[model samples]
Target: MDGRKPTLKSSQKVSLLSSSVRTVIRLRRTTQVLKKGLPSRDSPSKVLQRQQSLGKVKAGNQASFQGSQYFTFDTSAQPPQSIKKKKKRPKNPRVLYPGCSRKYLPTEHKSKAKRCLLLLVGIICFQILNAIENLDDNVMKYELDGLEKTMRREVFGQALAVENVMGLLKDYLATHIHNKPLVISFHGPSGVGKSHIGWLLAKHFRSIIGHEMVLHYFTQHHCPEGVPAMSCQLELSKMVTEMVTQAEVEEKIPLFILDEVESMSPDLLDTLGGFFHTNQTNEFLNAIYVLISNFGAKEVTDVLLQNVTMDLLEAQRTTEHLRTILSPVLSQIHPLWTSAEIVPFVLLEKSHVRSCFYEEMMSEGIYPDPNHIERLVSQLGYYTKGELELAITGCKPVVGKVNLL
Candidate 1:
């Protein structure tokens, strides 16, 4: 047995070396065998038997990970192979597609598709370039027909002395202001049309540029409950500068809308030296800034006394008083809600209010109580001419009396 061991080893070594060389010519042999003795796809055992008869081990091929073993498959005892069913793709439902919609996902799968290859990676994204080619045959084609239609101005309330104010606003907006900003302010009593004036100016040129509002009450810095609320002038100024920056980055034409300028906490208003002009790419404002407030008006006399000055009547005289009183407080407001006085809009008048209320209501097919409308318009007594016009542009048809204390 010891003497026969060398002979067995020699035979095995020869077989392994010959198999290694034969692997190179196996491709040529496979072609001839396939043409002459290939069995049906089901009879793989027969093919293996024929190869083995030709002195090939037909065992493990290293390339496809076949090691040294061939299945001496017994044909008589061969087991069955379980065939798995492949999942079939769903068929396209035949629909009368006559028009193409951009946002529609079609059910049909077409063999031919449009391809867009982005970066020359040889990979192409496929999509049907055009679908529902005939517009006359479909009604869905009109889905986006009215998208570009112009919107008519909802000039509801009165048209007081607002014409010049509107013109001034348009001109001021058209011309850019660098470091020196004009202080246009709208002052009035509570429930007056200060906010409405701001809204009007915001939408003056159909507001092609969207407006950004820094509302005092809504932002929680100044609450409606008569609490002095926190003065966030510095915070607000920072907010404005930041808005300008973000808008520039996004390439968005956004406006800055600040409401209730007078009620801005005394802490912030005291600091009026805040400056927003900057030379940096992201440091400057690329926005139309509009700051609004009722304190600019004579009616918010209480605010002036408590925060601005002891002699309340003096501060109520003009924007100069408001600006002068806040000079010492300017530093507190930066880098937010800067030093510029609040910009005013065109004022509204009594007749203009009535006309707007009537026209806007009629157009909407809405008829609010004439008495309520009159009562609301009467509040205009405390408003600037521009503000009153904004107030009456139109009263909403909701049932409620707006109590403007």
Candidate 2:
């Protein structure tokens, strides 16, 4: 006996190799099915059992390995892979400081002026709206359009004067607050509609603003020749204070008309001047004063008569000149006229007097014949200049003349 191991035949070795390859292929297929989560032909435990038995068979069959060592596959049961959880980010992550270990979030800056500016703008807008409302409430109380229409229709041959008066009234009455009372001094010759305008204003104000709110003071009617000047001054002051106080309580502006002011005593003039003073109460300041006078009648007439051809521009210039001339003269009389708005009344032509007669006749319910009106106008005295005859007594005598007709 030589004690040597016997070698297998080539055919037997080939068969053994084929059987091992088939067993390895089956095991690999089973592993792939399990990874894909598909149901395998055998359970995991059964598969493990089968693999163990095959390994045991290969170990027992030592002739298959001959004498060489070969690598063995571990088929032990492995725990199923556990699912890994992802880390979550925090809401406010902190960063380390540049020079320190402390961490903090960046601070945000805001402005308070923006909010304050918005509030300021809102306040300003509110004030403007309030002012506009006040202006509307104050101005709408008077029907200025109606007053203008009345003046245009009733007043004759004083277009410039009427327009100036209306303009002043509009400007003064636009607001209730005034630093000083409005003093309008009407200067012209007698019978040239100065007193007539005063009368019309009084009547209109009485109709619209209540009778108690309007005061018509005539120099002769209120303070006659027998009345003492001091007594007249006291009485005038008392009446004005009462009217103004009542008007203030009612939140209204009163109308004060003084006719024949040229004949008023200096004391009475001074008393009236106190009402138009700047350093007065709000009640006294918020009033309309119309002074009817023949202060510059001769000068006004001479200026109008000299012009001969008075257009709109020429009339405006003449009025300005008259104001300049009359201001000093009136101021010399009393300081009351210093701040007054002097409106010069021009002479009424013969045609204007004829129109006045026609209106008077129609108003009196008498038939207005052209020839009758001409004769009535001719009966009135006139001042002739450059073929232009102006009525000396405007519509003053028209009522009396019409009554006789």
Candidate 3:
């Protein structure tokens, strides 16, 4: 009694534990018997061991059990370590080439190419400018404007002829080079100023480019009556060769004028023709040949007389018509005229003769009087058509007439 519970004897405790184990074994045998109706591959001992392990593990982790399978969870177990995604690095362009400091682009090369192109353009521009300046220098040496003004002021009633001659001169003299000699043939009646134009051209050229550079050969004066055509041809050829050769050496264009070519023999004409050809020497090719002839005087006069009243436009047409009519006739006379540039000098009108009289008087240092000029113009014979009167002898006798005054 003292308040303590009654303690069982050791033998009684042992007998009670044995009876409990026997009761458990009996209950397991009964369960096995009951489950024997269904087939089971597991032995009773293994099934009991698995059940025991399941009960211990399921204490802390969530788990599910099916009829034959048992699932278990462990809360203390770590989740599978999350695989960290690796970040990809950007590629470097310099890795493709080692030890090269320049960029992969063609920017520097393209810049160099542009610089070369600009330099080439600058060189081309310089060459063009240089050529233009040289051309200017060649043209400036002639002083052609002064020549044009002098011709216009001195040569009267021949405006068209002056303009045409100036145009041809400017074109030919623009360059010092030539493929062939320029052969300008003046066709007109006597006293219509054919020889006068030739003289003026020779004089002007002589004043500008020395007298040796100009050869004004008068066929009649140079080859007088009864002279042998052969001797005259040889002499003429010698003179021309000397002049042209010397002129070529000096790099100067020479003027060769043959007046009264109507009287020149066939042999002499042929020699002159040889000089005008493209196959000739450089000296001959750089010369200007002016041939003054009265071979077509009758034809030129007849054509002008046919038009009762003429105007500037009609005059141009008449000139072209005269050229067409004269070309075949002159060409038939000599082959030299075939390549000649035919410049037709028309009949001088009565008014032109009057002006000529006045000019002659002034040149002779005599004052001019209108009445005296009219009187001088009246002395000249005219081929009249309506109010247009063309002088028959033109200003041919103006010098003699002024001398008489």
Cα TM-score per model: 0.36, 0.68, 0.70
lDDT of 2 by residue, 126-204 (tens): 9999988877666667777787788888888999999999889878888878899999999998777888788888888
> Alpha-carbon error at 13 in model 2, in Å?
61
What is the Cα-based lDDT of residue 9 in candidate 3?
A: 100
Candidate 3 residue lDDT tens string, 1-405: 799999999999999999999978867775775588543345789769867987888853433343225555565899999999998978774455565565566554456888999999999999999988876677667777888888877776777777778888888887888998888988888888877888889888898889999999988899988999999989999998999999899988888999889888888899888887888778888888898989888898898889645579888888889899999989999998888888888888888888888888889999998887887788789997887888888889998878886
Write candidate 1's Cα lDDT for 117-191 as tens digits. Answer: 343334322222222223222212222112112111334221221432443344433423334433344444433
The local lDDT score (0 to 100) that residue 325 gets in candidate 2 is 82
Please name the candidate that would achieve the greatest lDDT relative to the true structure.
Answer: 2
lDDT of 3 at 115: 92
How high a TM-score does candidate 2 get?
Answer: 0.68
The deviation in Å at residue 11 for candidate 3 is 36
Stretches off by above 4 angstroms in model 2 are: 1-133
C-alpha RMSD values across all candidates = 31.2, 16.7, 12.7
- What's the CA error at residue 250 for candidate 3, in Å? 0.5
Regions more than 4 Å wrong, model 3: 1-129, 308-310
Q: How much is the lDDT of residue 49 in candidate 1? A: 82
- Superposition-based RMSD of candidate 1 using all C-alpha atoms, in angstroms: 31.2
